[model samples]
Target chain A: QQPVQSPQAVILREGEDAVINCSSSKALYSVHWYRQKHGEAPVFLMILLKGGEQKGHEKISASFNEKKQQSSLYLTASQLSYSGTYFCGTEYLGSGANNLFFGTGTRLTVIP
Target chain B: EAGVVQSPRYKIIEKKQPVAFWCNPISGHNTLYWYRQNLGQGPELLIRYENEEAVDDSQLPKDRFSAERLKGVDSTLKIQPAELGDSAVYLCASSLVVSSYEQYFGPGTRLTVT
Candidate 1:
């Protein structure tokens, strides 16, 4: 099943903070975060393993809660370059081979 | 140092025409995936490949959509008799494994069917 992302869209000012949430119905082995600018490909941001292990870029951060089957992405001191569509992909264990199911997405606009 | 790459950044075709998109995964990556993204929506997985084998293709429309990965380094997705509804962005991504590794996406091919 695909993960569910909250807040269809968000607007923030430069240096502001924002959060994007992703939840899944099934147990997830990993949760991935990606950002795509207009007319561009999605860029890898971070990935959180089932054991609550988090890894990502230096500027973007995310946390996974195994108990809740959810993950949240936090953007601090947002910059104008952060404006893009954010998506969270979920992978389930026992689903066989590595496959990713992505959430709808969260459109973020950072005004400078 | 190079990321995933895709060709034909944009395509325009009439209904019933065949359209194909090509993708080259990152070097040394064994896992590859194809996804379809509609406007204003998130991407949906179409198929996945582990090496030269297709591990998952349940989401692919077998009647009109087909994909292949011969050498495990590059892949191709084809839509025969393309329909207007098939117009969307076809994205390809690759990862070392399905576990905790990040999947790097390539600039998708945007198809417009008339």
Candidate 2:
């Protein structure tokens, strides 16, 4: 099953903050975040494999909640370069095992 | 070093025609994957290979779609008698191992079935 991403689209100013959430029904082992610009391949942002652990880069970070089977990506002080579609790839415990099932996507537009 | 590479950035073929897409993954990656992405949708896995053996192909449409990874480094995906629905971006990704969730993706081949 595919994970569901919230806020199908988001518009923010260059220094604003935004959050993208991904929820799954299955028990997850890991959550991966990626960003893709128009006509470009998705680029890896971060991967959270441990429960309650959050990883960050620059102003972007993500947290995985094992109990809720959900992941949230946080973009603080968003930059214009952050304009792209964000996707979350989830790895679950069983059934169709060992695959990263991705979410639909969240389009983010950062205005100057 | 170099990232995954795919040939023919774009392809256009008439329905019922045969087409093939090739991929060369990053050096040393042992796992290769083929995913099909429809417009406005996330990619769906078509097939996955560890080395030269396909371990997960349950999502692959066996009747018309086929894939092969020879020598465990390069791979190819082929569609015979393509249907209009087959028009989509074909993405190839590679990782260090099956459980190595972090993947490196190629630019992908945009196929158009007319």
Candidate 3:
């Protein structure tokens, strides 16, 4: 099943902050975050495996809540290069295999 | 190291025609995946392979879609009499192993059926 993401689209100015949320109905074991630019492949940002554990890459970070079956991505002081579609991939518990069900996506646009 | 490689970055074919896509996973990677993504949407898993065997293909349309991985390295996906609805981006991805969480994706093949 696909996860649900909040704020289908967002617009922000440079130096601003944004938060994207992803929620799943089923129990989850891990959550992966990726960003895709136009006409490009999805690039991995980070992955959260444990509940309440947070991981960061540069100014981008993400957290996974195993109990709530949700994950949140935080972008601090956004830059123009941050403009892209962000996708959250979820791996459910008891899946036995490493299969990811991705969310719809969150379109983020950063402006000067 | 090179990421997953897919052939024919773009393809345009008429309805009822057959089409095929090829993929070569990263060396030493034991897991490969095929996903189809429609515009403005995320990638949907079509099939997954562990080594040379297909471990999951439930989402694949068996009636017209078929896939094969030989020697646990290269893979090919074929569609017979493709329909207009099949127009989408086919992506190939690979991970170090079946239990690995990080997946590297290729540029993807864009298919347009008229």
Off by over 4 Å in 1: A54-56
What interface RMSD does each of the candidate structures achieve? 1.4, 1.5, 1.0
TM-score result, candidate 3: 0.97
lDDT of 1 by residue, B12-84 (tens): 9999999999999999999999999999888899999999999889999999999999998999999998999
What tens-digit string does per-residue lDDT give for candidate 1 at A89-112? 888988764577889899999997
Range of the 10 consecutive residues with the lowest summed lDDT in candidate 1 chain A: A51-60
Single-chain TM-score of chain A, each candidate:
0.94, 0.95, 0.95
Steric collisions counted per model: 0, 0, 0
lDDT-best of 2 and 3: 3
What lDDT score belongs to each candidate, Candidate 1 first? 0.90, 0.91, 0.92
B47 Cα displacement, candidate 1 (Å): 0.9
lDDT of 3 by residue, A1-112 (tens): 8999988999999999999999999998888899999888899898888554689999999888777889999999999999999999988888756799999999999999
How well docked is model 1, in DockQ terms?
A: 0.76
User: TM-score per candidate, in order?
Assistant: 0.95, 0.97, 0.97
At residue A112, give the lDDT of candidate 1. Answer: 78
Question: Which pairs clash inside model 3?
Answer: none
Worst 10 residues of 2 chain A by lDDT: A91-100
Better candidate number, 1 or 2, judged by lDDT: 2
